[model samples]
Target chain A: MNALNLLRIAVKALQRNKLRAFLTMLGIIIGVAAVITMMSIGEGSRRSIESNLTSMGSNMITISPSSNSPGVRMSGSSIQSLTVNDVIALRNQATNLTAVSPMVSASGQVIKGALNWSTSIQGASPEYLDIRKLEVSEGISFDESDVRSSAKVCLLGKTVIDNLFPNGENPVGQIIRFNKIPFQVIGVLASKGQSGFGQDQDDIIIAPYTTVQNRVLASTYFQSIFTSAISEAASEAASEEITRILRETHRLRATEENDFSVRTQAELINTLNTTMGMLTALLTSVASISLVIGGIGIMNIMYVSVTERTREIGLRMSIGARPVDILMQFLIEAILISITGGVIGVIIGVSASVLVSGILNWPTVISEPSIVISFLVCALTGVFFGYYPAQKASRLDPIEALRYE
Target chain B: MSKILEIHDLKREFKVGSEIVRALKGVSFDVGTGEFITIMGTSGSGKSTLLNVLGCLDKPSSGTYLLDGVDLKSLNRNQLAQFRNTKIGFVFQAYNLLPRTSALENVELPLLYNPSINTKERRERAIQALEAVKLADRFDHTPNQLSGGQQQRVAIARALVNEPVMILADEATGNLDTRTSYEIMSLMQELNQVQKKTIVFVTHEPDIASFSSRTIMLRDGKVQKDTPNENLQSAREALNSLPVTEDY
Candidate 1:
């Protein structure tokens, strides 16, 4: 028989039951829409994280003290001993080392006459602002002279100033008492907005490393250590050199691990990105499960159609229609359902993704490759899932079918 | 094998709810070219089953049946379909025309399965077939639009479109009025005599069976009697000699 004639009959039969055909297509539409929407959200999140990490010192490295126990406190193993002596020694010994600052921090209530504010006070050298990309709004940072003399000066972050001042009042040159010690607020750090990880960034005070070390504590030891590498290329090597110097100065032998742990800023970002990427892939794949179920639904409905039309099959057979003709008719019906649903699903899914992203103020990308893959998957599912029913329809006994009421 | 249809020891048994009902017990018959034979039997006497076997719509359980020089038992499903497309035509008691389809398209159905005939030839042949049945005036009407006899005539035209050597009709006039029954019977007789088309029609009525040239009586799946109708022409003449049954 002519292929065109067979197609004509199939089209007419499918058209006879428009409501049933539409309902079947609805299942496929939902499945495909779920796949597209979930994947777009996952992709959007991945891209946002990539850019967020790039903004927070994309090539920066960070080193923190070691905490061997899972929930242990992590100041440092030798928190009471790291001093400016150790900082200067490392700066001189390592070739790729750029700057070093011995840090000491204390949380206390800051007072300025009628106003009082509580915040963490951090101390570092003049190069701390450059390393953290902090901009000083007023007054100069403490230099070598200030570190040597142990001058009591401070730099205030935007949040600390707002909490203590409220009005557009100048904080520079004002005397702010820290734990009852009179220290002058020499400058203020410009606002650095919220980090992508939801951490408040501008709620602290900066002071000279000397003042924080001597005034905040009555001890001769430092609380922490901060360092910066000359360039991104040498950051790893510089970290290793600093580790070697710390281990030797702490009187540790080669076999024994030191108390300090060094962590790179790049490594933190990498771990975060890898975990998010895995989450995206897992979520999208789980969504694909619905598509498989949709395929099964298509097969089941086709089987019902073939069985219901047995007498019609017999009628065609008597008119010289071959078994393959029946098979092709059923197969084409299934394919038409799946492909049509797939097309509508893609449109609906893409629009849904756009709507979600638009309302939430996030990014959504609908890649052409993903669309193509989705359509192909839908077509393949039709053929793969519809094969058994079509074969069963083609193998029906014409005489028995004609006898069927 | 040279005959248009031949059967030897033809038997068909069917099981219904644990009972093995033999529709056709050991029946054997042969039909040569241009022969019009009528099979007469009661409801469960297997006349329709015999026609199914003759039309190649069924397979005899344990018998040798030949149709148009090919063994019916040896042909696969696809081969049998092709053979039916070219060798056999059928008209059922129900006037089994698809009620939704137009007369011309119904006639063209068989020709579509025959690949040797192209579109122009197929349409021409289908029109000629409808013209032969005198349904050319109602070519566009669906089966429900025509009378029972016209529908049967359209079915006959469909059967003739492929120019098969024979047609097997199962109680072709059983559902029609007496006048329409005679009209359909006379059409078959004219095709048998003038066009030399062979036909085998099944019926339970003796008057309907008397219209054919030969009569084969069946009972309990077996041929009880087979003989030439030496008085067929005289019988139809006598039936026609009565007042013409009309619905004015």
Candidate 2:
């Protein structure tokens, strides 16, 4: 018989018991839906993290001093190995670096006409703003002359302005006292809503590194050094240059371990991507178990159908239907059930992903590959589970089947 | 008359749990075209076995059987199925029509296995066969909606749809009442006489056997008698003489 006639026969047979066929398909629907939803959620999170990191300068690099003693538990914050001289060495020698700056910080209470606020005072060269992708929205920025003179002029972030100048006063030229030392506000830094790690990027102040290190902290050592590469692809080369120059400036011997670490924004993005990819793989595997169970359901129903239709098979055989024809008929029936289930599953999964994103406020990306893979898996599942039953029906003895009640 | 079928020393054995049951022991028979023959036997008389062999449903263990000039023994499983489709028509005692299927579809069953017959031709042939059995008006009725006699007629229509060389019936009237049985027998008689269709009917009733021109009696896996009937009764006359019921 032709394939079309076989398909028609299979459909007619399934139509006899519509409820049973639908119930059999439910298993596959849920399985495929779960797989798609999980994959979308995972991919959405990875992309969101990448974009958030990229917003903060994808070519940015950070160099922090490692603990002096490897066996001792000391925070990198207390380490004083990085200095202004190392930043100068990198600025002079590193060809891959687009910009470089020394970082120093001191937390203290700032008072502006009795409107006092607690915030950290971060000190760096004017080039620090370019390296960190921060823009000055109003007024002028302190230049290299200000750093050489150890001037006390500062820039106010949006959070500090909101707290210290609550009356909407133009604080660009206003004077503020940090730790009882008066300083003039030179500019207002543009708003950077928040970092990916939940840190408020706008809750700080920026000044010349000389001012914070010599006047506020009374320390000559720097906390960290920040730099940017010419491009994201060049960050690795830039980091290597920093390491070599810092090692030479520290006068470290070739045999000794360097007391500093260099890290790039790309490394952070890769770590997060790996973690989320693992999570997606784990969830997708669990959901595929349901697909397997759905296949079993198809096999079980096919077995029952074969048993129920033994007499019909016998009648068809007597009328000259070959064994292969009977096999194709049943096989086609099982495939139809699974393929239909797969299509419905893809629809439900996409909708479910959208619903989850809307209700739970989670990021979800419905990728095309996940849908296509689910469909192929459903078709394969049908063939794998449906084969034996169809074979069993095809091998049935016509005489015995005719006698079957 | 040209010979439609020939069987020589046909024997079939069944292995029932290490015991060999000889169902047909060297049975031999030949049937000519347009002949109406009946095979009669009691229970366990091996008449059913002979019928199965004749229908190509079971191959004899040691025999030579030919139908429509093709060697039955030389054909494989698929070939036998094709042979049955093209050369033989079968009617069963229970009127084995598919439930929930219309009479027309049931009649089209045999033609479906033949790839050369397209959908339109299949439908036309089915309708023509239904008309031949006087059931063209009720072609859309399912088996449940049809009377037992009407269902048998539909089964006969299905048998005739393929235009086979002969019709093989196993107790075709075994489930019918006397009046219904006579009506079916009359139809069969008309198909045999008017259309020149050959028929082989298997039954245990001598009264039914009287309607055919020849009777072959089987007893204990062997043919006990094969005789020509001198007084072949007309089933249409028999059906007409029966007293009409009150409902009619």
Residue-level lDDT for A212 in candidate 1 = 79
Interface DockQ per candidate:
0.36, 0.70
Distance (Å) between predicted and true CA of A365, model 1? 4.1
DockQ of 1: 0.36
Task: State how far residue A383 of model 2 sits from its true place (Å).
Answer: 0.7
For candidate 1, list the clashing residue pairs, or say none: A62-A265
Question: Compared to the true structure, candidate 2 yields what TM-score?
Answer: 0.94
Cα lDDT, model 2, residue B187: 95
Clashes, model 1: 1
- lDDT to native, each model: 0.80, 0.91
Candidate 2: tens digits of C-alpha lDDT, residues B1-248: 89898988889999999999999898888999999999999999998888888888889999899998788989999998988888889999989898888899889888988888999999999999999999979988999999999999999999999999999999999999999999999999999999999999999999999999999999998889999999999999999999999965
Question: Candidate 1 on B102-145: residue-level lDDT in tens?
Answer: 89877887787777778799889989999999888998998889
Scoring only the second chain, what is candidate 2's TM-score? Answer: 0.98
